[model samples]
Target: MTANRTALVVRGGWEGHRPVEATDRFLPFLRENGFQVRVAETTEVYADADALATTDLIVQCVSMGEIVPEELEGLRAAVEAGTGLAGWHGGIVDSFRASSDYLQLVGGVFAAHPAVPADEAPAPGEEYFREHVIEITEAGRRHPITADLDDFTLRTEQYWVLTDLLNDVLATTTHPAEPGRPWRRPHESPAVWTREWGAGRVFVATPGHDPDVLDHPSVRTIIERGMLWAARGSG
Candidate 1:
C-alpha cells in the first residue's frame, strides 16, 4: 500500500538551528509513521494553485523572510481547504512581518525579546541564558501531545509572544530574569500551542534553537505528537 500521509517540508533562512538538520530528524519520524515526505527549499511551493489539495501536512522551517502574495495565498487556501500546517520557532510566527494576513493566520507575532539583551547594553555580550522550565497547562493535560509529560526544561529560546487565538495550549514556560526588582517582570511564555485555521490544524512549537534542542526527550516527544495531531483526519 502507498504511504498513509504526505508531508511537505520547506526549510530556509537564518541558519541558527540548521533548518535542514531539524527537517532531517523529522523525515524518518514521518516515514516510520507512514508518511511520504516531500522536501522543498523555498516558499514557492505554495505558489502552485493545487499545492495544498494534495498535501497532508506542511512542515516549515523558514525563518524571517519575504514571501510573494501568490505563494502566501496558495498556502492560506490550502489550510482553509483542510491541509495541516506545522512549524517551530521563528520560522512560522516571526516570518513575513509586512504581511498582516500571514501574521493573523498564524495567531501570534514575535515582538521584542527583552531577554536577548542588546549589544550596547550595560551587560554587553552577556545574555539571559538559562534552563527553561516549562509547566504543562490544564488544557495540555487533556491533549495527546502532552498527556504523560511532566514539567520539563530545555536550553533553548523561550518565546514571549502575544497570542489570543490558540485552541489548545500544550505547554508553557516561564522566565524569571530577576528577583524582587520592580523593573524586572516575570514572563509566562508558551512553548507549544495548537490551533485550528479554517478546516485545517495548526501546530507550533517555539523551542527549537539548535540540533541538540530537539534531542531532549520531552522536546522530541512533544514535536512528534504535534505533527501527528496537526495531520488529524488526513493522509
Candidate 2:
C-alpha cells in the first residue's frame, strides 16, 4: 500500500461550476486510493510552505479566483520541490487571471468558449454550447492518465483555450468558426495536457463545466489517474 500520502484539495470560486459538489465527488476516490484527504476552501493554504512540504498532491478548484504573489511563490516552490499539482477546467487554468506566474506554472490560459451568434444565442448553458468529440492524441495513448481510453463525445461547455508548446497535449478538440466572431476559421485547442515544472508535474483536463461532467466515466478516469501520475514518487 502507498504509505501516508496526503492529498490536499483547495476548492472554491464561482458557484456556477459547483466547486464543492465537484470536488466532493473525488474525495472518496482519493481516500479509497490511500490518500489522507484534507479540504481547504481558500487559496491561502498555498502560502504555507511547511504544510505543502508534506503534501503528496494538490487538487485545486478555484475558478477565476484571485491569488496573491507570496501564495503563488510558495505553491511554486512546493511543486518544484516535488509536490504534484492537478486540476481541471476553469478551476485551474482560468484561475487567478491577474497572476501570470500561475499561468507560467500551469502553461495554459483560458481564452474563450465559442458561443452562438448574438441574435440566436439562447439562455446560458443551452444549445449555444457545442457537442464535440475529444480525440486522444498519440501521446495520450501512451500516457498513464489516458492510456487505453478511446475518444468520446460529451455535451458541455467546450473550452477554446490558449496554450503553449510547453504543454504535452494528450487530447484535442476543434473549435468551429462562429460566423460573427473575430476568427472565421476552425481552430483546434488542447483538451487535456500535462506539464513538467521543475521537479513536479501538473495535469489539466478541460471537460468539467458541470459537476455531472466530472462524473462522466472518461473524465473521471482521466482525472483520477492524472492526480496519481502527478504525485511525488509516482512511477
Candidate 3:
C-alpha cells in the first residue's frame, strides 16, 4: 500500500547532467512500485500549492537553474509540511545557487568537481565528465538505503559538496590528492545522506551525474530504496 504513494518528478536544467535521460531511468521502477508518478519539465510545478500539498514525494532533477521566489517558497512549505523531498546530483542539492534557504532545506550544495583533463575539456558548453570510486561508510552499511550495497567504481564526476552537519551520512568518497587542487588533504565528501525537515524527510545521493551511473545495479538499488524510505519516513 505504501507503494501506492504519489510522486512528482520535475526534470530540466543544464542538460549536461542529462536530466531527462537520467530521470527516465527511474520511471519504470517508480511505476512498478505502485507510485502514481507525475512528470513535469519545469520548476513552475512547485508553485502549485494544492498539488504539492497532496503529493507524498518530490523527485527533482534540475541542475544549476534559478527558481522564482514563489516557486521556491511553495516547495519549501510543501516539504516542511511533511512532503518528502528526494534527489541526486545537482537536481536537489545544486539547484537554486543563490538561495541560501533552499540550500539549508536540502542540507548540502555541490561545491565543485575535479577539473577535467586539459585535452578533455569541452568546447564551452559540454559537461566535463570524469570517473571515481564510491564507498559505503560503516554507518551506510547499516542504513536501509545503502545497507548491503558494495563499494563500487563509477565513471562520473566526483562531486565535492558542502554539507550540513545535521545530515545522516550513508556513504562517502575521498578526493584523491592532486597538486593545485583546492583541498590539501584527501577530503571525505558525502556521497549519500538523509535529513529531516520539519515532518518531512530528505534523501540525497551525489551520484547519478550520467544515466549510466544510475543503471549500475548497486546505484539503482540504493536510489530505489531511498525513494521508498524517504516517502514513508522510515527505513
Candidate 4:
C-alpha cells in the first residue's frame, strides 16, 4: 500500500531505557499501518522546520535529554500547527526537565517512580518494579485508542505523575499512601491521557518502562492506536 502518513521517530538518551530497541519494536507496526517511518537519534530533529511541517506524527523515545531553546520552540510551533506527538514512559514526560515550556505543552511530567512498598517489596534486584493496576476510565472505554480494553495490571515501574486539568484522561493508576510516606491518602495518577495543542493532538501512556513492557499485548495495541489517534486527521 502506498504510504499515506509520515511518522518521525526521535529516539535517544538514557540507554537503560533502551530507547533504540523500544522505538524499533514499533517501527514495523507503524509501517504496516501506512506510515513512512523515519528514524532520528537526536532531539535536533525537532529544530528543522521543514521536516516538522511535513510530518504527520512524532513518536519520541528520548529519556532525559537536553533540548535547547530553539529546538524546543520549533517543536512547540509544529505541534501547535498540527503535528501530532505521542510517546510513553520517560521518553515523553521525563525528558527535557529543565524546560518549563516543554512540560506545559505535554501537560504532565514524570514526578517519580516510587519503588514497591517495603511490606510487598520483591527480590533484592527488583525493588523498583512495583506491581499495580491500571484502570481504564469511562472516557477511555469510548475512546478509539482504549475502547473495550480491560483494566490491566503491570509489574514494572509504576509512574507517579504530576498532571493538569486540561488533559482528557483515559486511564489511571493509583499509588497507595504507605504509612511512612508524605501524602495522607492514595494518590491517583493518569496512566494514559490525551491533550489538544492548538491544531494538533497529544497522546501519552505511562505504562511502557522498556521494550518488554511495550510488547505487552494491551500496551502495544494502545500505543499503536494512540500514534494514529494523535496524528493529523484521526477519525
Identify the leading candidate in terms of lDDT: 4
Candidate 2 lDDT over residue span 1-235, tens digit each: 4647999999998888899999999988888888999999999999999999999899999898998888999999999999999999999999887888899899898998877556766676665466788999999999999999999998788898888899999999988776667788989999999999999999999999987789899999999999999988899
The number of the candidate with the highest TM-score is 4
Hey, what RMSD does candidate 2 come out at? 1.6
- Evaluate candidate 4 by giving its C-alpha RMSD to the native, one decimal: 1.1
**Lowest-scoring 10 consecutive residues by lDDT in candidate 2?**
120-129
Candidate 4 lDDT over 114-178, as tens digits, reads 87778884887578798789999999999999999999988899999999999999999999988
lDDT of 2: 0.90
What residue pairs clash in candidate 3, if any at all?
none
User: lDDT of candidate 3?
Assistant: 0.86
Error of 4 at 196 (Å): 0.6
| Candidate 3 residue-wise lDDT, 1-235, digit = tens | 3556789999999997888888888888888887889999999999999999888889999999999999999999999899998999888878888999899999999998876667666555335456677899888999889998889988777899998799999999888777666667788899999999988999999988777778888888888888888884444
Looking at model 2, the pairs that clash are none
Q: What is the TM-score of each candidate against the true structure?
A: 0.89, 0.95, 0.91, 0.97
Error of 1 at 15 (Å): 1.3
Worst 10 residues of 3 by lDDT: 121-130
In candidate 2, residue 213 scores what lDDT? 88
Order of the predicted models by lDDT, top scorer first? 4, 2, 3, 1
